[model samples]
Target chain A: MFVRNILSAIIISVAPVSSVLAAGGDTPPIPSQDWSFSGPFGTYDKAALQRGYKIYREVCASCHSMKRVRFRNLEALGYNEDQIKAIAAEYSVEDGPNEDGDMFERAALPSDAFISPFPNDNAAKAANGGAFPPDLSLMTKARANGSNYVHALMTGYKDKLPHGVELSDGQYWNTYFTGNKIAMAPPLMDESISYEDGTIETLDQYAKDISHFLTWAADPYMEERKRTGFKVILFLLIFAGVMYGVKRRIWSNIH
Target chain B: MSNAPREKFDNTVVEWVDSRLPIFTMMKNEYGVFPTPRNFNWFWNFGAIAMFMLITMIATGIVLAMHYTADTKLAFDSVERIMRDVNGGWLIRYIHMNGASFFFIAVYIHIFRGMYYGSYKAPRELLWILGVIIFLLMMATAFIGYVLPWGQMSLWGATVITNLFSAIPFVGESIVTLLWGGFSIDNPTLTRFFALHYLLPFVIVGVVLLHIWALHVTGSNNPLGLEPKSKKDTLPFHPYYTSKDFFGIIVFIIFYAIFIFYMPDALGHPDNYIPANPLVTPPHIVPEWYFLPFYAILRAVTFNMNIYMLAGLGLLAVFMVEFIWRHKPKYLNGFLGFLLLVLGSGLAVFGLLADLNQGWEIPMSAANLAPISAKFGGVLAMFGSIGLLVILPWLDNHPIRSARFRPLFRIFMIIFTISVFILGYAGSQAADKVYFMEFNNTMLAQIFTGFYFMFFLIILPLLSRFEKGRELPKSINEAVLSKAQKAGA
Candidate 1:
């Protein structure tokens, strides 16, 4: 029994060793970038942001309100502050702190809400059936692949989109919608927004950047987060190297 | 001299980053060595993977719970609002949803690893028991979480499972109402399920810590089922095992990320796409696939067949076998024990496939959808799992002090292999629905389920008799040398 037991043990032990040895023939590749909190942030193109803003102003701003953003905040993304104020002055906003502590109407300050496309909630819903067109302020960060999904939804419309499905006159179809059967119509057009840079002419680019800017608006601190993560990882890596030698020293007597 | 203190501090940070993080140090101090075994194979890394899944679930869940409201009016809309309005909420939700499935995948692998390596044998019994406890808690937590989404599937899954208690003789109605907190599944049920689901993962975490503690006390059982006898038999765990575990975690995370980002909804049920409607029942309700085996067992006991007499007795017998029988190892009757185990596992798999019948889509019409038979496959698979597990100790007939001399045990291993194949075939055959109630022979069916129980309880003690097996090996080296000579000749 002792012999058999010992024999069985050796077989079990040796099989794994051979398997481990066999693994050297098929070396798995390592990822180029080790993703961590410290990994470099994904970069956005500047031209994309300018076009995205135009799309937002022309298409999205009509129905939705970015109540949290100031017109001046646009300058932080490379637009001049003067240009920001000029943009803000175009919108009429509700004001306060008057004799009754509530002034009724004024030109928008840096703190004003973006212009609403519809006159009211009822009008917006009436135009698009009973379903409410959601606010776009944070839509890019609200859903997984929000920018791509939104962009796909905007450009996905086709006549006779699929099967015998009938679309309402104003309602459009998007190929990229989750169920491929969304209620919302295609909202953007190539000629809808004319830009100084001649870039917003593309239907796809317009959809892409509006999505990007919305993403940025939702998580403005993304750049800061990525930078901090990188430094922490660097510090940890250096610390690990020094500790290895210490561990070796501590366990030297065990051998 | 003043530079000495600064140099030391810098050195400490460097060392901590590379080899001596406070976490690692604490683990080392608690575990008492590095790279303790050089040969754990791929299976040992699963515990760490399981840990990673838990951490992922907790992090994503905390973020999701922040935006979620438990009110009846706002619950569904709250989910929609999170999808449309909250920053990064979509990613958080997707990660949490996929994370649950990934956690189960890791736990299943860990359990199978334990089984393959004989990690549950003898001294490591507490580890296995704690693992089972963790598994139970995990199931409870997941069931509760499923209800929180307030989807059609969630409502129906809850309704079906809770209704199972209605099969009880007299007090079943009261018991179910007590469980539901009312006569029907309503706001009280949803509120209670949400609360319990939120509470259960933390309970799992506590149980997991106990699982690891038990594992550490026994150290890890290696693939060879042999204990290390000398310093040459082991290595420090830090650089060796730590690196392997780290690599395993990274690979596991990559797969998890793919599920989180690309195919987040692949594991989800389509019925959940529709909002929860308490008034309407889904065409077919099924629990998550992980719960299918148990569901099958519960259903196998058809109504009108004294469920209390058969199912109640069967479950008690199983509990006693799993827990009480651990103390009396000699009572395990090797061959019949193996058959009983195979039968039980076949029944479990049969249950799983039965639940999956409606989920799969085919291009065929209703006329073509006449139920295909797979009942035989279910019985076989269930029995196969039970067979191998119960007969294992006897199958290793070549005196197992060391793995090197267990060549003759290979014959029994072949038996196990054939049994699994047959069981798998039977399970495939039993996947179709059984709709004939009048012809179903309900009493005879209960007898089969009862036999599945009796096989385990009655036959396990008789396996040792009529077992004049192959001669045992005399020494580890002798066994190895003899094999080598035979190969050469």
Candidate 2:
């Protein structure tokens, strides 16, 4: 019955409001992709890689939990363990028992998974305002446009509305991400982080790389996916050739 | 001739700096040489100022957010924690709060500067239009950001504004509910507000990029208002403009710092000090100071029957002045231009004065009876602004070629100045309710508002036909510059 009701509502809304919704423009992609990080032919962009790392350190690591990844794993992404440890030690986590036998918080270890700073979901939601900003572990994949949408959204605000909504004195509206207008104030900034890569600190470059890092976090198996795809394609090509030869032999004999 | 050929040498320091810190090289590729006017001017600096505010607000906002709570129950306490407990958190919060005020201040100036200089005209229309877009986004972001603290003003303000959408035809209620995330402004609204507040600055940043790009494409109009003629007429963007913009930024920062540090709450509502109570509404809910002008405009219209007309008229009037005042460039001699300077300055001064004292009592009759009424200063100032702007082209009537004498244009400028002073004086008066009620009509209000609209829409366009030719001086620069300087002084 609920399904029927929902379907009926959708039909009703669409039949009348399609003109309104479709009038402004088509519904944008669910999660937009950032193509800058992934270069032509799926090559990793070095500048994007460095920027991605910077975004991780400056933004994501503050509140979000990447439970599957380790600080030390950054070394594989090309950071030295010393660099990784220095970054990890920036945050203190709860661990060993206190003198009263309660667990105590301490500096995060290179070995530790990226635990959320909040105590629990309730704490997170309470701090953020009743909405537990979801762990962005698989956010890139979960979102519609992959990484591009995130990058574009970061810098997409204008002062005026395209429609009737009136903003208060200090509020701004971003166009790229969902919500038509969003609340997550633009996070990335030019010269916000001191980059090691000598790339000029540009908001675009920063957003692009951070988005790339998030994309990787969401699907750590991206490289594997690409590899598997290539192998399957190669296998299919060889199989097609063999089948063609076999069919020719059979046909020749029959003739 | 071989005294020993001197060994060719490369400066390693220069190379190293170029490789390691290529700020200049990158700048060259993107913006070209220092002072590159290849096109811009003082009007172009606002985007940079806007960018600086975005960064300042975001940084302070994140810090505040770190200490803030989003739940309906604890959101107020969390704001208190920011004010009372966190180290330098109060300062950050206040700066963020006031930074919002200053951001609007800069934007209004930026917008007005665009208006006077014709920054939105022609090829640069997109830039001006994009600026409007940026302004809209800024408003949304600020509104949601204000609500996140969940203070009294945040709550009541949200209720009032959210309820406004219910005026829409049909699905208004549902739309409002969807916006609120519920029937009333509560947990869901707070959450959604936070999510959106967090998001909009990035959008502003995006539009700003487009704004600058549009400006770059249009280049910038010069102080002389004459298009650049040659390579000799242009300069590298670095030392010339970079230095000038840097100077502007410094001066702006000094003022910004005063507000951020000392008078932080001066622009904020006193009611916000109290915690939000959904059941209670503040006695006189007013938006921030930056929005006061528009609020005044909104309040000026007594009848809901003409709401859309009033609103549209007010908005369209903002850009109407430029068109009305627009005249053939050839006819705008130094003397005539000087008159415009005087009128423009007077209008600005009056606007500021009108905005300042919201509740000053004005004496009305022979009995010397003074009573407090809602200030009509904004209305009067706008009235003056409308008159001057709409009839500008007619007032500065000069034929296409005659630049030698600008007596007619000068007379128009004086007329514009006198009208502005009269309108400004009238604007300072409190709205007379006795007169308003006894009249039993909005005819007086309409007369003022209508004249404001008509001057631009009717008078100025009509004046274009009567304008005769004027003779030009040897140069567009010397004739206008000296005159403007004299008028400004």
What share of the reference contacts is kept in model 1? 0.00
iRMSD in angstroms, per model: 18.7, 30.0
Question: Tens digit of lDDT per residue, candidate 1, span B1-489?
Answer: 011122122456655653533553445544436435544667888988999899889888877888887766567657655654577676678778888889988987887666545466667666777787787688778877887888778877777656545534477568778868887777888788877777888888898888877776677777566665555556667656666666677667666765654455667775664557776655345567666544443334322212222333354456446433443435555554555556555544443343345453543233222221222222333343344444434322222322223343334334433443333232222222233663332233333444444433443323223234444444323444476589979
Q: Give the top-scoring candidate (DockQ).
A: 1
Q: What is the lDDT of residue A179 in candidate 2?
A: 43
* Native interface contact recovery, all models: 0.00, 0.00
lDDT of candidate 2 at residue B85, scale 0 to 100: 44
In candidate 1 chain B, where is summed lDDT lowest over 10 consecutive residues?
B1-10
List runs of model 2 lying over 4 Å from the truth: A1-255, B1-26, B32-45, B304-452, B459-489
Residue lDDT tens for model 1, A159-209: 676566566655555555543556665677777778788664777766666
When just chain B is superposed on the true chain B, each candidate scores a TM-score of 0.67, 0.67
Give candidate 2's error at residue B241 in angstroms.
Answer: 1.5
After superposition on all C-alphas, the RMSD of every candidate to the true structure, in Å, is 15.2, 25.5
